[model samples]
Target chain A: MSAAETTPQRIAGRGAAPQRSLWHVILVRPETMTLVLLVLAVILASQLSPFFLDISYILRSFTLSAEFAIVALVLTMVIIAGEIDLSPAANMALSTCLFAWAQASGVPMPIAIAIGLVAGLAMGALNAFMVIGLQLPSIIVTIGTLTLYRGLAQIIAGDKSIRMPEWFIGIDKVLVFGVPATVAIFVVVSLVLGLILAGTIFGRQIYQIGTNEVAARYAGIRTRRIKLILFLLMGLAAAIAGMLTASRLGSVRYDLGLGGELQMVLMAMLGGTYIFGGRGTILGTFLAAWLLVVVSTGMTVANLLPAIQLTVLGVLLIVAIIATNLIYSRAQR
Target chain B: MNALGRILARRETGIAVMIVLFALAVSLYKPQFLTLNSLRVILLLTPLVMIAAMGQMLVLVARHVDLSIGSMLGLSAMLTGMMFRDLPEIPWGLGFAVSIGIGTLLGLVNGALVTFFRLPSIIVTLGTLNLYRGLTFIVSNARQVDRQFIPADLKGMSQTSPLLGIPWIIFMAFAVALLTYWFAMHTRVGRQIFALGSNPIAAPLRGVKVTQVTLLVFAISGALSGLAGIMYASRWGFVNPSNTGFGFEFQVIAAVVIGGVSINGGVGSVLGVMLGVLLMGCVAAALPLLGIPGTAQSAIYGAVILVALLIDRSVRRQGIARFKAARA
Candidate 1:
């Protein structure tokens, strides 16, 4: 079922055309809030520690969350389409464990990587089939799969970290134009996804589906097919992220990227993506990712406890959603 | 007679049959699985989940989920543990009031966010799950409440049985279930919760105190989880900042869903939930006997949840078809 049926608040078709100023259009957007927050976080973080101002240090820290950030790009699309996938983090662990296990067992590295990608696609297909084919709710379906995938990863790896081949490690260390490869990948992915979300017919249809599925379907939007494709893309992105993580860590474990879902979802929410779906931008998430890195890295540099950082992220998620909801509801009027 | 027959053929019966079949199949593979000791093992594994599932059931029936139950359990248990460790002179019974009280407060925060702000409960709880967990670590300074800090009498609740060799915790879990049954079936507010979940818009129109009922379910859920938190210390005799109540929402959700509580809300039974808890306990107990690694248990739980979802869906479809047919 679509989110509109479950949630009480449903924003219908653009009600009326009220004359709006350019400044209202730009400054009133959730993306603008994200931008403001990014600046605020940077200034605040810099005040917290002298070392926080280092560009290279911040870039290095950005690489740490770059894997999740990359996945968040695709996640933004899925959420816009009015569904969610909580299983990607688990998908990362499972696919990477399979990749690492395959390579360690003497499979060709190329074949091993392919195996990982295909496994990720297959997991995505499973989610799509349950959600699209069986018509199950995405939230609960993904939660079930999340647990299943993580559990399977545990069974496969058994509390052991499978080491990656020497040459395959350190994708984060390869910098181009003073940016880590993973960080660069995150930026490129964000731009491409941002364009797809804003500039493509397909992207507009996703918003339509999220806004009202029955209306979209009646309008011949192929809602199920579009959602299926979105779920598949989510799976593929998660797989790529898994390999990136494995390369960075030089090993694969069942707990790889554990709780990464919270970070990815936090990115989406902080970027002003409405939790109930149908409104958000890739630009918001992109800036939010950097904002997160600055805040977290600042805390780390200042010797703040990780517990406090966790608290801050949690509070940020709640606050961001509340703020985004308020902005969208007001904008609708 | 036909209506009575249909009533007898309920989800609870189906789950009960599955439980028996599963036990018999396992026993065939290992005769020892049928022994009383194996039953004891299964029962022992269920008390914590059983307590939490009742609260989870109410939350689900209210059409809102509380993912933060696990973290609430952790935080409450940690705080209670800290009290025992530092205070030393306080009566052990106070831990119940304190843990449950803290859980109620945290749950009320969740309810407030969802009701007053109109945020979705799932997202709100997901946020608090991390928030409470981080608070637990901050409060405990990342230290575990060691076994020595836990009162011996509390720990003894798990081992010492007052009747029929069943531990006190098991009885406590049953008492909670019975209380939930009474609250859900006999109380007007209980039915109001159902009315609210079945149709939120219609609920307010019907004078169902939307905010009050919503907050009540969450508070009840929190209070029960608090009870489970202290029971966690009783059962395990220690509370680690990171490990206590970790991933507990999954296990409890699995049981509730397997009990045939509809995710769409306003449909559940205490008996079915109790049976679901037992089924999970059986599977957990059977794993070691069957030589399956403990790592596979979570996979089984996940698989069970999905399968249960499918079963619930099909049953719902059939019921809808039958309703249409009868009307025609």
Candidate 2:
């Protein structure tokens, strides 16, 4: 049994594997595909409209989805660890609503922010406990929490939008060396997470856990703890993203970031993250984020209705998953 | 006595008992809840969910889920609504064919993607959920079909009663449920679905047609959602692109789970699901009477789903333990 398990790992470790050409290595990677798609999207957008090639306009547009992109980086890790959290968008709504409501009701700014962050953490902990402690499936568990969190947000905010302090608004307008602050944060988070996923032993363990949980446990990895940490990080990232969104909009409402989970999942899937788990990278998600921004911005620039854009996004999600799955299966050969 | 014990031990009976208990508890606070008028209200509120839950139950029993049911409902209803507005001369009965036909086609698309590409149902349906919703918007130009556009005969389905003052829609919902119960219990393909869901790998070895069964469940789910779509038009007297069936999948899923349909698949009953829908109806009707705001409805649904999941887990564990003891 041990030998059967270790054989795949041994073959995957460079030494026992058959030699492959450099082109095969480069062309077969899902990340490479994502990069190619990114380039293709840029070209397509430019052809659709004359003004699409402006780097500044594209940069400005990137800020709109920067929060989702940041959360997608964390989401990529969670998917790699073979679990999913669909409630993050709802988490964003609830956390932000709490923050806004607290501040509006005469709470201090710092405490309100802390309240939001802690609430996000608690939500994550609940998910972790349900999934890890109770051994419930993450997909369904997250779906349940998604509804709960969104519903809680609705109950709290009750069809009203709460205004943020004037000074707290417009994080997107705050430029960092010619880039929007939100965009800058996305890039930095991507870089940090990318390195952690690619360079750390912890990252390899996550891959192992996703690949085979029993085998990973036998290999002495603390699978539950790792998953718990990932869920907590997901909650934290969602909270931060929520605040960023609140700042950008200058208000908070129950519907804040409504349907944002679709965008986040689309980014991760486009990046070639295997839905079943164990094979994905932050770099892929990073490139996919830009690809999405280009496609949506192009549609917006072309004066297409939002309905058409929604159709395009849905088609892209299905196609991306299919393409990524095919690419992975082929690469295995 | 033995037959009674067996019946009492069934999941359907448990759900029925819960419904009675819940309704009684609610009545303690508001005696009006027990009135026939309130019963009519509860029944009216549940027809759409009941229809959708039957479809969802089949999908769950097949070890798959259809998240796109809501979108399918919206798209079908939007199309039927458009037909009414554009071609007012067409017979009103043709709307059922159009709506159900569109739903079946959309469901087939989901099934094809899942079976052909071997992708997960959850992701595929999630994609189509957006796709269908987008199509609904595109088809309707983001406008709503007004009350005037809906046929008077169709709207009467919700108001006019054939028996006991219950709306025709209520009877129609029960008819669908009875049909589903027969289909699930009596049909060969129905048994095959349970067989396929219970053990997919061994199912092929047992001569079950995997692809066909999967496609069939999704198609059935889609068809039912489509039926519910037209019902939405009748009951509400209008169909809005975004508002028609938004968050509908959650409500159906919550009801199905609470009805004792296991998420792991291959175990459920039509009666349980029907009772579950009734329970949800009771809660919804009770909320306004109990002075709880409407906004709390979604939260309660969410909580109910989680609680149901916990219950499902414990029940399965107990079943396993009992089986072990019997073996010993």
Candidate 3:
């Protein structure tokens, strides 16, 4: 085997590659870098506030980002498949708006919820059709759809916030075993996604497709169909997240998750996902989600303005991607 | 007949035809839409997008995208507005220079990150987009530049017309477009940009200075966005940190794509981009006349982008097929 191939195998601990050492495994892995940063952020965050170490306070803050964390899990999969969907944040808005509008118009709650989920599925189908069926670049196509979806949400909601039924509000307040329901959902979903991505044939094909679609196609993988399914899954996840958001906020507006695409992408990038595709893990994203919550929560507690928070998030995105790319490039060598 | 067919064969002709059809449809519903005053509204509304799209066209042609133009516009506009607010004695024209200079610096930052780190332009600009916007808020202390602080002369650019009753901002936009046309068509460095976009790998082999061209395109994009930000103050008489250039990139990108600028790079023209901006402007102007609310305006812009992508894709496929047949 080539030196590069042997290194990964040796790191997996299945074989002995003489040149491989513990330091190489520790320093070269993108996840290792993420773990280091995550720890630093936690320590720094705890120092910023006396309450930061309290389990209840952390759980409450995690609820604020739980929906996005859930969606980020699917986004990690999509990026690993070599395609991206920038429209999920918009998807959440439109789908939730549809749900709220339907219920406000006197539709039954369950049916309205169904309508919302279906709208999300349809949105995903449209994205799949454009990116896979029409053979267009996912990046540009999603940017277009992102605008389109958000605009539609505005048209539907029209600067008005529709209220949900009283019983439906505050999923964040609903706790199971002292954890918010949304956070529980996030954990469960992350576990499932992480397992699938790491241990399944379907998941392996996704990596193969992302690494090189043409090669994957030649290898008998149904690249187009797999991408379409991933897109659909992304849509479903965004829809579910949107519903959770509405429950947390008690209302739905066109701007429900306004500017959320930035945070979602930030989560994936921070989790050490390779921007160019073919590499990333759900576990990394899971840790990154908590890291981001701690960092932002710490900033909030320190009385920093939202503008500064925005600047910090932007800087973090750049630094994270740069560090991950460097790690990956070095590993390749 | 032959000349007509050749003219029709160009991608710009398709956009022109769409514009005509759209205008006719709107005018038929409301004949007042065809009036000269209404045309002026469309023309007036187009200058900012027109200017920004020229820069975007070049960047897109260079095979890189710049999402930070909107934030660049916001930051530069905020800076200029602050200057006029605090240093009232400074000549208003200096605002243009300052804005453009800051914009160039920001663009160079983007270029440095993309080239030096070999990072993707989209992600870099996305980061800078927020970064620059946040800086704008920080520097301005979240305060908007009020109308009273803006100089009368600066605002007069949008109000006063030296020719054909058109605003000076429109003239400035056209002038920039003209300069861009000359650069893209006549200059060696300009041609090198097209080469870099068409094939980055082959560009180095052909002696194209890939780094220089990429940096230049990004810088130009920033400078133009800066110009647009200044024009925003002229048009609106105020500059709000968050509102000045919000969603501006989408409008410019929609216009550039509609203008037949291939997203894959190496193709576009000043004339096509101009027509694209005009088409978007006409639609925007027609919306209010047709009783369509402002909320639907963005959706239309998004739909227009997708349709343009479809048209661009088909046209490219046909061209490829024709080239193969000729080769065969």
| Candidate 1 lDDT, B94-192, residue by residue in tens | 999999999999989999999989998878888999999999999999999999999999999999999999999999999999999999989999998
Per-residue lDDT of model 3, residues B228-284, tens digit only: 989999999999988999999999999999999998999999999999999999999
Instruction: List DockQ for all candidates.
Output: 0.56, 0.56, 0.55
Q: Considering summed lDDT, which 10 consecutive residues are worst modelled in model 2 chain A?
A: A1-10
Segments of candidate 1 deviating more than 4 angstroms: A1-17, B1-4
lDDT of 2 by residue, A1-333 (tens): 344687788677746557889999888988999899888888888888867788889999999999999999999999999998889999999999998999999999999999999999999999999999999888878888999999999999999999999999999999999999999999999988998889998988889998999999999999999999999999999999999999999989899998888899999999999998989999999999999999999889889999889899999999999999999877765
lDDT of 2 by residue, B1-328 (tens): 5999999988888888998999899999899999999888899999999998998999999888889999999999999999999999999999999999999999899988998899888889889999999999999999999999999999999999998888899999999999998999999998998898888877777888888999999999999999999999999999999999999999999999999998888888898999999999999999999999999988888898899999999999999999999999
Q: In candidate 1, which residue pairs clash?
A: none
RMSD of each: 2.9, 3.1, 3.4
In model 1, the Cα lDDT at residue A10 comes to: 44
Of all true interface contacts, what fraction is found in model 3? 0.61
Error of 1 at A165 (Å): 0.8
Candidate 1 lDDT for residue A120: 95
In terms of lDDT, model 2 sits at 0.92
